[model samples]
Target: MSLDSSQLSTAHSGKTDLVCYPTSHHILFWVNTVSYILPPIMTTNGNDRTTQWKTTIIVSTSLQNHDTSRMLLAQHHRIRFSDAVKSGSIVFPQSGIAFLIINPQELPENLEEAGLFDKIKKFVTVHRNSFLLLQAPFYGKKELDIMSVIQHRFLGSNLRVLPVRNNTEIVKGMLTIAKATSKPHVDSMRDRMSLARAHIIESSSVWEMLRDIKLG
Candidate 1:
């Protein structure tokens, strides 16, 4: 779960069995580099019996950038980027770390938005081994507000959040979050109610407050 590139590099070489999962909106140069260095492998138990296990890296990006992403990752034949998720043209693998890169601008404004939220939720639900990594550079109240809504909803659903400001941090954060093989318990009623009350007191929004209550 460590983010250190050197550490991850070691793991990628099979020195240690530690696996890192990265689901990104865009495939960074480093990501493309790593995929080539580490082809996915099936680990076995002490008895030398292969398990239903694999480590992967998935990057999802927008249709507009789909071509560009593919070109960048072209040298790494193992890496694939597609715009098929929206059209239901894609089929996810059974087990492996995958990167889902999507166009950030195409993301829904909130969890209630049509198509976007449901599509993402369905993807994550089906890929129980998946962990979502949302990225944005928020420099204003409006942007932060949007992130707050996303954070509240996902956190309430027991998804871990890691706020990062740079590529290094993003890589580190994703690895740290993905190492856990279990889903966290859903937020308790008291915790949910407390969040709702805080939102109400802050006069955030009726919708946001109600969303918290519903999640509880």
Candidate 2:
């Protein structure tokens, strides 16, 4: 089935015609005959929960006219443009996270010649918690090479790499990550996790055996 923003809205609201199958921590949903795995914000009852998380996105002035920025605005996210941020960068201030969006097609064939490493180094230095959003239509050799180089160079740094196919994926990735890392929501997730852990311990046969042995 074809998926659009409206379909995403319904899916996010836990009301969708599409059948979703959970795989570990992600949910697999089919769109346009292609399956996509999305990490759902799950509640205590195992229901996918979202729509309550919202935060302002600080966009660089260079991306003011970009499709990614427009898509975020269309999704009803509050966007504030600033010149202080690096060009093609977006900041989630509440989460202390920043993302530098780069188009793989625009990158030079010789990465070192383009000084890509220096640019990324500056970006990481500016934002302690940062991500590199590498946009590519497909994960061809070029894309993989770029991702591999960045991952190798940034090892042990406060930087992560997210590969996005389109503007839709970009927005989805950003929102999902920002919501999970932001305030109040992160705390709530911790509480739910603790409860889940307690439930597991209470229901475990090993725990019961240990208790019986101790009592005996």
What is the per-residue lDDT of model 1 for residues 1-216, given as tens digits with 9 covering 90 to 100?
Answer: 112434334433532222333433211112213221222222343331112212233445343344423432442423444554433212224233333333334455554755655655666655544444444543355445645665666564523333444444344434333323222311222233233333333453544666689899
**Which one wins on lDDT?**
2
**lDDT tens digits, residue span 1-216, model 2:** 123444344433532212212112343443334344445667788775544456899999999999988888877788999999888899999988998998877998888899888889999999998889898878999889989989999998978787878887777777766776678776754444334334444565766888889899
Q: After superposition, how far is residue 10 of candidate 1 from its true place, in Å?
A: 27
Segments in model 1 whose C-alpha atoms lie over 4 Å from true places = 1-77, 82-95, 99-111, 156-158, 162-216
Q: Quote model 1's TM-score.
A: 0.37
Model-by-model lDDT, in order? Answer: 0.38, 0.73
TM-score for each of the candidates: 0.37, 0.70
